[model samples]
Target: MDWLNYHHLLYFWVVAHEGSVSRASEVMHVTPATVSIQIRELEKALGVRLFRKAGRGLVLTEMGEAVYRYASEIFAMGRELIDMVRGRPLGQPLLFRVGIKDVMPKVVAYKLIEPTLNMPEQVRLVCREGDFSGLVADLAVHRLDVVLSDTPLDPNLKVRAFSHLLGESEVVILGERKLAQRLKENFPDSLDRAPWLLPTDNNVLRRSLDLWFADHNFHPVIRGEFEDSAMLKIAGKAGVGVFAVAAAIRSEVETMYGVELIGKIPSIKERFYAISAERKLKHPGVVAISEAARKRLQ
Candidate 1:
């Protein structure tokens, strides 16, 4: 076999892991054309077809699957080597790529790590805010050094509870003035009458809320559904309907919009875990950030 190009191998690995050229392109911050070309070049050099088109996307062929298995191991070893060299005092500053769920307010995340960002030693802190599933998947693939998320890690991945108590709060924000007044007048009883803006039915938070409602026999009039907190907040502010949100995030919601929590429901709190590949714990940079975030957030 000809000497393999590391960059091409990386592109191939990402495409194989992501299972789609478009998704790999997003993670690599490159164009789909670039990824396709590189993968083609890699296949040409190896004298084997690595992928086959399936509908609009490419699926790894038998040879591609075999190569990907080895490629993953090779990349993992390369990362270990880089980490070992970077750990030396005279070597380059360690690069720590962390991922956080989009649900987490960026401002709060920044505030938590403000101190470490100014450290004298050259440390590269790259933070990517994304959905929980995508972030977790990336962490499992060694694309992220660490991930701060409310969701549980996959069975294949290793996770530790950095923050034992993930404190969250839920309150209904009434959009209409008449509805707000009625809610206030009726107090807790009015909760069942107002139209509610809820997270998606599959969201853990939403599930918790449903359970609470079931236990209390309080059925809310759900008017809208949102997958993103930002959108829920906006809808509430626009008087479209009532919305539920974390209490700690109330300040953020109030600052940007004119909305008030109607009645306090039981706070929805969960455990937040610091997730990473188990082998990644050997890296000093990964350990440092995990400890730092655990201390700050927990």
Candidate 2:
């Protein structure tokens, strides 16, 4: 491979950002033809086409996306370097991009990320909520600094990342005040034939709860199953049915949803994890989150 020309890379990066050579030329104060030539030279040096045409605009190819990711990081670091050399106090906060799995309880996610806000170095948090697989893909591509999930990353996935076990919490059952008062009488036995809101069967928590139910021989009447934890809690809050949450955030759940605690199931615990591209965490914000979560959950 030939030595990389940073000038060519800068042109390519600008064109990617602008989505067209003409717009990139306007930003860089160069002719459109100049930008095109520079990008073509970069493509030739890298031995791969970077952009593809779509609706009179350009979109990045798979390899192009990968290159763009690197180019972004490189330019970001370069800007930071210039700031340091100029002795300019960096008032701008560092960005901490994270992904939260959709099935994760919103309150739990907030607790895990809350410590980063108090760090000595300022940090701006950006959260992306999606399915675990999609979040894992973004983490693999370096788009997300970390991912918060109830379950650890599956080894079956080919992504190169490490799952750091933040900690685990016992599951706590909850219900509206009146329903909880009624069920609190019999404790575990009261769960039988009780109206219950539940997570969809595909969720890890739901699967674990299913085993616990089977072992205890409890047959609760299912009111509804939800993919969103917040919606399930909302239904539970309206006296739709009882639901469960992580004991670590039990107080917040009750306060936020105006629900009462039915009981805690110590036997059934929910684990939390932080998945990142690096085995050894380097980001200060990520480290703060991991540390805080372990302490809180423990």
TM-score list, all predictions = 0.59, 0.72
> Candidate 1 at 210: error in angstroms?
1.3
Give the Cα error of residue 15 in candidate 1, in Å.
Answer: 11
Provide the overall lDDT of each model, using Cα atoms, as 2-decimal numbers. 0.67, 0.87
Q: Which RMSD does model 2 reach against the true structure?
A: 6.5
What digit string (tens of lDDT, one per residue) describes model 2 on residues 144-166?
88999989889966456789999
Q: Per-residue lDDT tens digits of candidate 1, residues 142-241?
A: 6787776656665533222122222233443444455566677676666775678887875666887788778768888887887676777677777777
Which prediction has the highest TM-score against the true structure?
2
Which pairs of residues have clashing backbones in candidate 2?
Answer: none
User: Any idea what lDDT model 2 has?
Assistant: 0.87
